[model samples]
Target: MTRVPFTASCSTSIHKCCLVNTINIGTTSLAAFPNSLALPFVPHTKATSVRRISVVAMSDLSKSTVLVTGAGGRTGQIVYKKLKERSDQFNARGLVRTQESKEKINGDDSVYIGDIRNTETLASPIQGIDALIILTSGVPKMKPGFDPAKGGRPEFYFEDGANPEQVDWIGQKNQIDAAKAAGVKQIVVVGSMGGTNLDHPLNSLGNGNILVWKRKAEQYLADSGIPYTIIRAGGLQDKEGGIRELLVGKDDELLQTETRTIARADVAEVCLQALKFEEAKFKAFDLASKPEGTGEPTKDFKALFSQITTTF
Candidate 1:
């Protein structure tokens, strides 16, 4: 038997040089190349397969300016901070409703004060952003004169002009419109998991119909024709992230399970991960996590997002 050698080259601006080396073991020719190549390993009939693998790398090194609406909120702050930490890949910007909220994040220059409910205020923050993460939601405040010691459920209500319809539906619609007009590439929306049921307990909170209105915005975003990722997270907890097995489902199915809550930090991480992967695009699903120590913590976000097939 005689050994045969052939030169195979891949041309791309992403890499200085991409070389594919083919070896013949008997009648079969196997191609060996860098794992960075986007193609799967397969037996090649000829050296021309090298051209097939000449595609650009999946990871984009260019920095994207990402704006986090509601950046003062628990999960939003985490996402904003994570992006700021990854300065090489992202130009992180935070949008808060008030100056006090801005001060909470150390009054960073990157933080922008804006009212998500008002489209006019969002213009400056939405300008020239490559992506937008919508973390804004209506807040429900408990009515006065109630105590936990009383052992009775406290009533809830949204402040004047801040109901679910205004904040969840209209505010989000405005953001979508503004982002679309700005030529934003991607949008990641974090919402609650109970949107499937109109009578879900959350909707009854403050007579706000929160989930109902949120579902409306989710659909609007889906129809906007812009690439989007909608994450309806279940029962957000303040626990540590990256310590539990994250799960995804559709139509609030995960709400029935005991593991129906996820950490705010994990939700923040998922929001950022949605921006990195193509599979996470145009997808919407319920997000939850198993109890810590029950299984291995979720690390491969690409695999986790690949499990979702739903659109809105």
Candidate 2:
């Protein structure tokens, strides 16, 4: 490791200001930095410095408040439990919609019963939150025996705030807006693959065109100017996580040929891992678990994240 002299200078109207210090890192440069992501990330806010700083990608989860929406849902529940495993680094909070839902969230998480569709309900839950991992969706309640892993179920056949347009698009948009207003440091969205192609099978449920709406929300989050990571997941299975090596790709490339499956628990792990990986910010990728006999799950998130083609 070597120490490099780091200086951040900003100019507004004919005035110039600079903050100078020496930083210890593996690699960085003044020119490459202007487009690079930084951590101990600076939040997007009026008080934040206009100049950008870049560091060799690293994730340090410490003394931050992380709020996970849809905490009562399958994926969110896993994230809620996992975040608590590192209680020294994060204050894990879960947002459910009702008292009944709150009771379903079993953990040391600070549970907030609130609806993502209602902006007013979100304010309190998002306030002072450092990071947000969004797993909420508008998928309609399933019919008995409707296993998403089984391949022929309508994934978004229900409505009443669970519709793709309402929950996936607008509800997610609401969460992004609230994150900005709260001055959140970062956000990670758990979205589905095939959203780039509206004709995908998963979109056929209830004529939902689910992927289309999810793309709208994805675009909104990208344009929201918040540091964001959008994990486009494959079939969300109910199997145990961390068993298979995760396959990660970009632009739905892997989804085009493989209609495979990944566990919801593993998706939660990816979302949690993105919290500290500065490399994942402003990037999106599609992920699915490999076959059962594949091998042990990859433990180095930064190594896996480094393999994705970053579009931002």
Best candidate, lDDT: 1
User: What's the true lDDT of residue 309 in model 1?
Assistant: 88
Model 2 regions lying over 4 Å from their true place: 1-61, 107-109, 142-156
lDDT of each: 0.86, 0.77
- Tens digits of lDDT, candidate 1, 6-88: 33654554333233344344345655444355434345455323343233233333567899999999898899889998887
lDDT of 2 by residue, 79-191 (tens): 99888888767788999888888887764448998788889999988997899998888765555666778788443458565788888888999999999999998989888
Which of the numbered candidates is closest to the native, going by highest TM-score? Answer: 1
lDDT of 2: 0.77
Cα error, residue 310 of model 2, in Å, equals: 3.2
lDDT of 2 at 168: 85
lDDT of 2 at 244: 85
Clashing pairs in 2: 59-276, 138-162
